[model samples]
Target: MTDENNKIRVLLVDDHPLVLDGIRSRLEDDPEIAIVGEAGNGEEALQIATQRKPDIVLMDINMPVLNGIEAAEKFAELLPDIRLLMLTMHDSREYITKVLKAGAKGYILKDVSSSEMLIAIKAVYQGKTYYSSGVTDILVNESSKKEVPLTDREKTILQLLAEGNSNKHVARELDISVRTVETHRRNIKRKLEVKTSAGLVKYAIENGIVEL
Candidate 1:
């Protein structure tokens, strides 16, 4: 009963076949969604995504040969237009931060109901970000404690640093000079009240800024 013109093309990427089947079955009930393809691993997922170019990809965290984090990073580079919605069982801050930094538009737990999944997909497709209710408290608490709020650019720099990217690399990627990167690094450390790079990374990982 789906309308061909209105349906949102989707691609499923998870290592577990049963997980793919369950998600496909749940989504097929919606008239606005269409499962265009599926992949059991990140490599296969990348292939399907490149060929089918789905509007959304429901990615899982743990997978063989290029986990969801790596796949998402590549996908963002190759298919900038395709939005990624992470659908995984893990809600750990490390997993959440890593995937988001990899360019995912949303994150939702596997325990999410069918309706919630649909809402997440629609929100990401519309260029908005979504996070499950259980994880919202972590974000809220972190946001509220900021005596020194970071700018978007600052956050980007911090995220890159937490990913273990070198200052030179961060500068090149962000189109800033090494001196500037260092300055931002220092400012970020001071603002977060952290003394070392390890401390910064730890905070970022715990706060969902970087993956585990």
Candidate 2:
């Protein structure tokens, strides 16, 4: 649990051992932050997260088993209380937008200074979102762009619901809370403007949101 005292619990996830070592060396001395665990990929990160329950996950983009954005989607479903912060080398607007939509609460480039990193960690730990200066500019520019109707995760849940899977079944398959599944169902309904299970099926079939 991130609750082992009042210190902020953090998990460091990156494929490069050097990167992990660097972050560990830097943050390990901070009394306010506890490095709960480390993972080399998204799958391992998820496993460790279940065991450690970090309050914030500092993740990278590229990984072997599962990428960070996809993992962020899963984290959004499974651990809605935890915050995600992407610290990667990717600075393109496209990457930034995708990670934000994937449920990252903050994005900071790898080149960020250690001081700023500390500030960002503290900020998100306190329930405030943080983005590095360059990322802030990208966010401002992307603020007006409209996103697609449903995220990949939402479409997956929609497919399950349309396939006659109950919320409990969907939650079990997705490894998420039933309440989280219900929240997604409500959002899928509102986004697709459908009020019934039949309506969801029809929309899924018509829009090809599901393979059927």
- Candidate 1 achieves a global lDDT of 0.81
Query: Residue pairs in steric clash, candidate 2?
Result: none
RMSD of candidate 2 to the truth, in angstroms, is 11.1
> What's each prediction's TM-score?
0.69, 0.66
Model 2 lDDT, residue 105, Cα: 67
Report lDDT (CA) for all predictions.
Answer: 0.81, 0.82
lDDT of each residue in 76-156, candidate 1, tens digit only: 888888998999988777787677667787789999999999999998787656677865555445443433367788889
lDDT of 2 by residue, 34-152 (tens): 99999999999999999989999999999999999899989988987788889999988778767766777678999998888888888778765567888766545444534449999
TM-score of 1: 0.69
Off by over 4 Å in 2: 1-4, 141-212
